[model samples]
Structure formats: C-alpha cells, structure tokens
Target: MSNKVTKFFGSPWGQRVSLLIIVILVMILFQPKFFSLDNVSSILLAIAIYGIMVCGMLFVVIIGGIDLSIASAAALGGSILSIFAKGSGYTVEGFITGFVVAIVVAILVGLIHGVMCTIFGLPAFVVTLATQYVLLGAVLVVTNGAYIYHSDFGVFYMLGNARPLGIPLPIIIFLIYTAISAFVLGCTTYGRSLYCIGGNPVASGLVGIKTKINTIIAYIFCSVSAFFGGMILVSMNMMAGAATASNAIGSVLTAIIVGGINLAGGEGGIPGAIFGALLVGIINNALILLGVPSDYQKFVQGVIIIGAIALNVYTSRRSENMKTPLKPSKKTLDSAQSAKL
Candidate 1:
C-alpha cells in the first residue's frame, strides 16, 4: 500500500492531482464556503475568459513561442466590436460585421507575427512585445481613447452574460474550446508535428513537417482565441476600452507556467493548462474569501509565482534524473567477460 501510494504520487499526472486535492482540503478547512455552489460558479466564471486564451496560447507555447501581444490583441478585438456595433445601433447585422472584422484583423496580426518570426528570424518575444504597443495604440485610436458603454443590452449583451441550463455562457464556451483544442493536440497529426517542431524544428523540417507553416497557423489560432475571449469579456462588462483584459498577459502566462507547461516549449497539454487556470482562479478566490487586502494580494501572487516556478524546475530535474540509466553491476560485468572467454 505504501509503495502504491508512492508510485501514484511519482507520476506527473498523479502529482498534479495530489496537489489539487491538498489545495481543496486546505480550502475546506479554512473556508468551507469555498465549496458553495455560488462561489464555485463564480470562480469558474472568472477563470473562463483566461482559460479560453490559455487554449490558444498552448499551441504557440508547445512550439516554443510566446505571444506577449495577446492582452493588447484582446483589447483591440473588444474595441473593434464595440465601435462597429455601437455605430450600427446594435443591430444584428452590425454585430456580425464587427465580429467578422475583428477576426480578420486578428488573423492579420497573427500572420504578421508568423512571418516576422519564421521568415525574418526575429525572436517571438521581440516581435510580440513591439506589436503589443502597436495593438494597444490601435485600440486607443479606434475607441477614441474612451470607454464604450453599451446601453441597449441586445444580442451583444447576451453573448457574454446569458446563462443556459444554469451554466454561464462563458463556461460553456470555455469547455467547448478546451475540448476542441485537446482533441487537436492529443489526436491529430498536426498536433504531433507541433511537439516535434518545438522539440527540434530543424529536424522536423528535414522530415518534411512544414514547420514554418504550422507555426504560422499556431500563431493565428492564438490570436483568434484571444479575440474571442475579449469579445466575451466586453459583453459581460457592457463596456470596451484600451484597458480591456489589460492584466490578461500575466494571468494567461502565469497559468501556463504554473500548469507545468515549460516556457521553453515542446512540453505541455490542454489538461495541464486548464488545471493551471483553475488552480490560479481558486487561489485568487481564496484570497478574496479570506479578506486579504488588495495590496497584499499582488504581493502574495508574486510570491506564489516564484514558488511555483521553483517547484516546476525541481520536478523537471527530478524526472530527468530518473530517466538516467544506472551503471552496470560488477558481478554482471564479470559474468559477461567469463562468457566471452
């Protein structure tokens, strides 16, 4: 029984599961209300937006890239949708038009990142960081540096706020989005190729994996996911502005890191990313429930991030060490020599 317990906890999935269980037990002991249906729903609702973004970000991260511009990209998406929809009196046609336009722009931005990274050999961090400014500037320009407040509460409002069968729309969207992402990553040839490319792009291309094109597609998907989440966010708030999802970069990246997805790339999955998002959400919720001051919350979060990163590195090293073969025993070596004689 002890051996079985140790074996279970040694596996990567088992470790994560154990960590989750421990967190839940702590929450139950300290704040029993954490299990209340309303609080659980609230936590899910809050994490759903970032969870959606994490799905898209997983693709790029798998291929060993980062998209620092996602927050700005989301802001741009919301700003575009609100501007066009408001200009058209909140008509259905206007909403569709804005949605389509926002998607197209997102695709273009993603394509730009892909080209600059794959063709020009620029680092994704540099490209995305520069474009982050460009996207934020575009948001400011499009929204005229003012917050867009939606008063009509039409289809646009329902897109984010509506509850179906007692489930929030964002949660449903998140689940569906995660399902699709997981299927593609876990089942498809393209997904497998992404792992290969992330691990060793030169070898992947030598094997006719079309690494550049695949990377480009991954970037596009990431941008579109960010846009989709941004639209939902603005609808929920009934407002859009340059500040929309401003803190998302940190939240999304942090979730990815905490979930055991290596920032260096070629190692992670949808389940881990989602678990990370959920864990972060629960921790933040716990902070609120515990009445931790807002100022202290940020400090606590920073410390948590550092601790999580250290733990991640330690676990990775341990796993790698376990893979190393032991030296041959002296008796086995002597027997082999006697057999040869």
Candidate 2:
C-alpha cells in the first residue's frame, strides 16, 4: 500500500490521476453542474479543439522544439477557409479548394519554421516568436483586420457541429487524430528518428538521421495541426478572426507540460498530452461553473500552471535521481563491515 502510494505520488501519470480526482471532488462540492450531461458534453467539445493541436504539437515538443505561432497558424487557416468558401458561395468546389489551400499554407508555415531553425541556426522559440508576428500580420493583411463570417459550412458542418454516438464530432476527430499520432510515434521509423534527433541532434546526425528534414517535418505537423483546430473553431463560431488563437499558446504549453512531456524533448507521449489537455479543459469549465469573475480567471489559471510546472520538475528530477545509485562513504562502509563481523 505504501509503495503504491509512493508510486502514485512520484509519477506524472499517477499525479494527474490524483489531481483529476481532487478536481472532481472540488467540483462536486462547489459546482454541481460539473457532472451534468450537458456540461460534460461541452467540456469534451472544448477539449477536442485544443486537444487536436496538443496532439500535433507533441511531435514538435518531442523534437525539443517549441511553437509560439500556433494561434496565428490557426487563425490563418480558419480565416482562409472562410474567405475561400465565402467567395465561392459556400459551394462544394469552394469548400474543397479552401481545404486544399489551407493545408498547403499550413505546410508552408511549418516548412518556414523548420528551415529557419534547422538550416539558418535560429532557436526554435525565437523562430516561432518571429513567425507568430509574421503570421498575425499576414492575417491582418489578408482580412484587412476584419472577421469573416460564413453562413454555411456545407459538408464541413458535421466536423464542427455534429454529435454522433453522443460524442461531439470534434471530440471524435480528436480521438482519431490522437490514435494516428500515437501509432506514428510508437510504430514508425520517422517517429523513432524524431526521438533520436530530439535526444541529441548532433549525435543523431552522426547516426545518419536527417535532423534538418525531420525538424522541418515536425514544424509542418505543428502548423497543420493548428490549421485543423482553426477550422473546427471557425465552424463552431461561423466566423474566422485573427484574435481567435491569440491566447492559445499558453494553454497548449500548459497541456504539454502537464502531460509529462519534458520541455527539453524526447521524454513524453500522447497520453500525457491528452491528460494535460483534459485537465485544462476541466479546470476552465470549473472556473466558469464556480462563477469566478472573468477578470481574475487568467490570474488563477497562471497560478495553476505554475503549480503544475513545479510538480513536473520535481517528479522529473526525482525520477532521474532514482536512476543513479548512491556511493556509500568510506566511514559508512567501514562501520558496516565491523557491524557485520
């Protein structure tokens, strides 16, 4: 019992589980709506939004990189989708063209991120930071700083608004994407290369891994993921705007960190990311239910993030310490020999 307790406390998985339980208990105490079917459905839907992005962001994080431009990427994709579909009268051709174009742009964004970092020797964070503004500026130029609304999503309506098997379509997509990501990371050569590269780009290059190419691929995945997320958000709102993802990076980072993926890369998986995303979803819902004022919610959320980071750091260091055995002092060794004798 004691060992199990220790394991639960010392491991990220166990800690998240405990945190989940505590959150549930608190919700039950202070916010009864937390358990309602409607509320549950809403939370799941919300999770599917950022959840999809988190899943894609996993590849980048595992490669020891960061993306500060996810919000802009998402905004651009959704904005473009709205514009194309609107221009063509929301017809099937417009939808198809918009979808393809959005994908291409997403890939291009990722390529830029990867190339600048891998070839030009820029820091991932710095590259993404610069790209964030660039993408945002592009959105402003394209939309002329206006929100584009679409009256119809055509066939795409199902992706954002439908609920089959009592699950929101976004949630379903999130699950499918998560499964695919898990498989690719767990079972593919590319996945293994990503891990290796993230562990040490220089050493991996010596082993014949194309670190630059893989880094490019990782960034593309991140941008593409953000694109999908943006589409879903636009579908739900029936509008695309530049500010849609303005505050999203912090949430995504919190999810990745909370999920047990090391910020340093190559140490975490989709399971942790999912848990972290869901945890954020639940907390956000809880705040709304608890009547926390909008002005203070951000502050509270920051505090929670700080706490999770400290806990993750503590557990990571503890796990590392456990791997290295202690060397006994000479005095202790001599005392032990005498006692045994």
Candidate 1 stretches with Cα past 4 Å from truth are 293-298, 319-341
RMSD per candidate (Å) reads 4.9, 5.0
Candidate 1 structure quality by residue, lDDT tens digits, 1-341: 99989989887767778878888899999998999999998899879998999999999999999999999999999999998899999999999999999999999999999999999999999999999999999999998899999997788988898999978999999999999999999999999999998999999999999999999999999999999999999988899999899878877887897788888888999989999898878877888888996556556667767887887778777876775567555567899999999
- Cα lDDT of model 2 by residue, 173-208, tens digit: 899999999998999999999999889989999999
Clashes of each: 0, 1
Query: What's the CA RMSD of model 1 in angstroms?
Result: 4.9
lDDT of each: 0.90, 0.86
Residue 326 lDDT, candidate 2, scale 0-100? 75
